[model samples]
Target: MQIYKVGGAVRDRLLGKPVTDIDWVVVGATTEEMLAKGFRPVGADFPVFLHPKSGEEYALARTERKNGRGYGGFIFHASPDVTLEEDLIRRDLTINAMAEDDQQNLTDPYHGQRDLEARLLRHVSPAFAEDPLRVLRVARFAARYAELGFTVAPETLELMRHLSESGELEALTAERSWKEIARALMEDQPQVFIEVLRECGALKVLMPEVDALFGVPQPEAHHPEIDTGVHTLSVLEQAALHKQPLTVRWACLLHDLGKGLTPEEEWPRHIAHEHKGLKLIKAVNERFKAPKDCQELALLVGKYHTHGHRALELKASTLLELLQSFDVYRRPQRFEEFIAACEMDARGRKGLEQRSYPQADYLRGAATAARSVAVQPLLEKGFKGPELGEAIKGERLKALKAYKEAASV
Candidate 1:
């Protein structure tokens, strides 16, 4: 059997990037032969084995045919007769179809190298349209390599639009869709991922809540980018630029969804949108089953991002209530992430990206001051049970009151 390094390993190497994980495609190999050679089988839908020594995945060269609908409706055929070219043709993108031999000779029958030089992400064949997952994969690749000026080919984008219009994207399971969505959010240009999906019309099908934001009006004074959708994408860009974690990025993406639901008659003024957005965020989280942290943070940011923006103006009691609502004493990290999301929102406006965001530092200082009040001192003054809890809260409020006074001075 001849083993060749395939997929992302070869693609990243060609791009002069560091290769982290290497996948191998074995030609002229059967399952029985792999087992006899001390490889461990792992794939349930196809013939994939782990190398005994290297522990890297080594999948047998195989071909697939669309058996039904969605990404999972496929039948795989792998045998000694399967050619390397045949296996490569079944892949989603041309750049991902090249393989490397032991002698370092490249087999790129699909002209992946040509596309790489052109900085284009093209499909290998018409067969690329058969899998719905390719739409997200190509968009994600666009997000990943956008800094290198990579773009999806027009014809391939047409196929993605066709797939979106063909009702196939809806067949993707939430888990499958979330996998791509989460990975794209972590990319350096997550906003590009959404842009590509919108161009292909997949955003309307997969995330209508977000899609509705397009063309929706906002106050140009606050958001020089008057479109709610444009501002949301800018927020996502800010999140990526700051290298924020996934939870903060996710919050930034969904924080303005309520603005999409605002009445057109109320254009440019979503007076109570922060409260209006909480249910929408909940629905999106429920649809994708986002991680508990992601769901909770999204809700908090959606419902109280305005409060974070108004940090300096809020009354000391109101600020204390907000801090207690976040339960910062128990989960400070979540509170920090909330501040990050708010900062992204504030700085996402057009021509205002470099503006200062003192609200973040101010709120952090308030939390620090409130927490510095000693519960031991209150207890030593004969405060007991519920009374002790009240005394501690009173001291904490006094600390915040003093902090607010000092900051004003």
Candidate 2:
């Protein structure tokens, strides 16, 4: 059997990127032959093996045919007769279809290297439309290579649009969809992923809450971009620029869902939108089955991002309440992430992308001051049970009040 280093390893190496994962394809190898060679079978749906020493995946050269729906509904054929060229042709993107031999000989049956030079993400064949997951994969690749000026080929985008319209995207499981969404959110240019999905209409199918924001108007004074959708993408960009965590990025994306529900008569003024957007955020969380931390943070940002923006103007009691809402004392890191999300929202507007967000520092300071209030002091005063809880709240409020007064000067 002849093994060839293939897919992402070859593609990234050609682009001068640090190759993180290396995939191998073995041609002229049957399942029995693979077992006899000491490779451990790992893939449940396909003939993929694990190298005993390196523990890297080594899949047999295989061809696939669409058998049903979604990405999982495929029949794979892996045998000694499967040719390397045949296996390469079945890959989604041309740039990911090339292979390299042990002797450093390169195989480019699909001209992946040409597309790489062109900085284009092109499909390998018309068979690319078979798996709906390719739409997400291509969008993710677009996000990954966007800094390198790579773009999806027009024809490939057409196929993605077709997949979105075919209702095949609806067949994707929440787990599979969220896996891509979460990974893409952590990319350097995650906003591009959402834009690509919106362009292909997949956003409407997979994330309609976000899709509804496009074309929706916002106050031009506050949001120079004026479009709620544009602002959302801007917030995602800001989150990425700050190297925020997935929870922060996800919260930033969903922070303005209520603005999409503004009445036409309201036009630019979405009064009470922060409270109005909570249910929609819940819908998104339920649909994606996001992690508990992500869901809670999204909801908090959705329900109180305006409060975060108006932090300095809020009453001391309200400030303490907000800090408590975030459970700042127990999970200070999560509260910090929440602050990051809020800052991204403020910086998301056009012409304000680089503006400093003093509110973040103000909130963090308030949290620190409030947390510094000693419960032991109340205990020393003989405060106990429910009364002690009330006394602690009173002291925290006092601390926040003092902090607010000091900052005002």
Candidate 3:
């Protein structure tokens, strides 16, 4: 039997990208033969096995039939009669269908090599429509490979549109959907994937709230055209450029989700978007089963958009009392992450007149500076005893407020 590297590892290596996982196809080998040759059986739902010596994944040549729905609704076969061409046909993308031997001899029966060389994303076979998850994968690939100038084959996009409309895409679990969506957002060009979702009409199914942002106009003083969807996309782009953490990136995308749910008549004149936006983000976060940490970031971004105005108007003692409740000044990354979201929120417009206020920069900057001097110093001092602790706390609060005000100016 001959073993060869196949799928993503090979594709990534070809593209000069880092290989994170290794996959192999064993030609002219049976599962029993593999086990006899020191491979352990590991795939119960499919025909996957692990090599005893290297522990690398090796799947025997197999074919399948749909027995259920979504990703798990399939049957597999690994027998002597199955050819590498047949096994490759079962794959989704052409570039992923190629295989390479230890000698690096390419086995590309379906022009996958050609597609990769051409920097195009194309389906392996007409059978691509049979699996619903491929739609999401195409969207993700668009994001990950947009810089490479890859375009989805028109027919494949059309098939995705059909599959999403038929509700097959909905059969996939939210966890799986979120995993793909999150990864796509992590890509350098997230807008490509998002735009693909919009083109395929899948955004409505996955995030209908976002779809409402398409044409919603904000006030002339607050924004030019102020389309909620445009603002959200801009926020996402800014977060990506700044390399914000995933949770913060998510907050940026969902921070303005409430604007879509608000009444259009309120527009520029009576915008209480921060409160409304936070509530919608909370519901969306819950639906995605986001962790408490992520939920907290979303809530903070929502909460503090209006807090700056309230803070600017408060007396020092009152403001100190209010800010003390958060302790956000103690955690700089948390505060910076919130600011990253806010900064992106503010930049999502045309001119200065469109801004909600003087931008959230002053508040975010002030908070960051305060946390750096006060919280970090206290932690570094590491003083013990009740009197020392109280002294540190008192000094920190006093220093934090002054630092914050300085940053705002």
Best-fitting candidate, measured by lDDT? 1
lDDT of each model, Cα atoms only?
Answer: 0.94, 0.93, 0.75
lDDT of candidate 3? 0.75
Which model is ahead, 2 or 3, in terms of TM-score? 2
Candidate 1 lands at a TM-score of: 0.98
Please write out the lDDT profile of model 3 over residues 213-275, one tens digit for every residue: 778776666566467677677767767776777888787777767678667667644366777
**Candidate 1 lDDT over residue span 1-409, tens digit each:** 9999999999999999999999999999899999999999997999999999989999999999999999999999999999999999999889999999998899999999999999999999999889999999999999999999999999999999999999999889889999999999999999999999999999999889999999998888888889999999999999999999999999999998998889889998998998998999999998888999999999999999999999999999999999999988888988999999999999999999999999999999999998888888777889999999888788889999999999999
* Candidate 1 residue runs with Cα over 4 Å from true position: none
Report clash pairs, candidate 3: 222-354
How many steric clashes does model 2 contain? 0
For each candidate, what TM-score against the reference?
0.98, 0.98, 0.83
Per-candidate Cα RMSD to the true structure, in Å, reads 1.1, 1.0, 4.7
Candidates 1 and 3 compared by TM-score, better number: 1
> Which residue pairs in candidate 1 have backbone atoms (N, alpha carbon, C) closer than 3 angstroms, thus clashing?
none
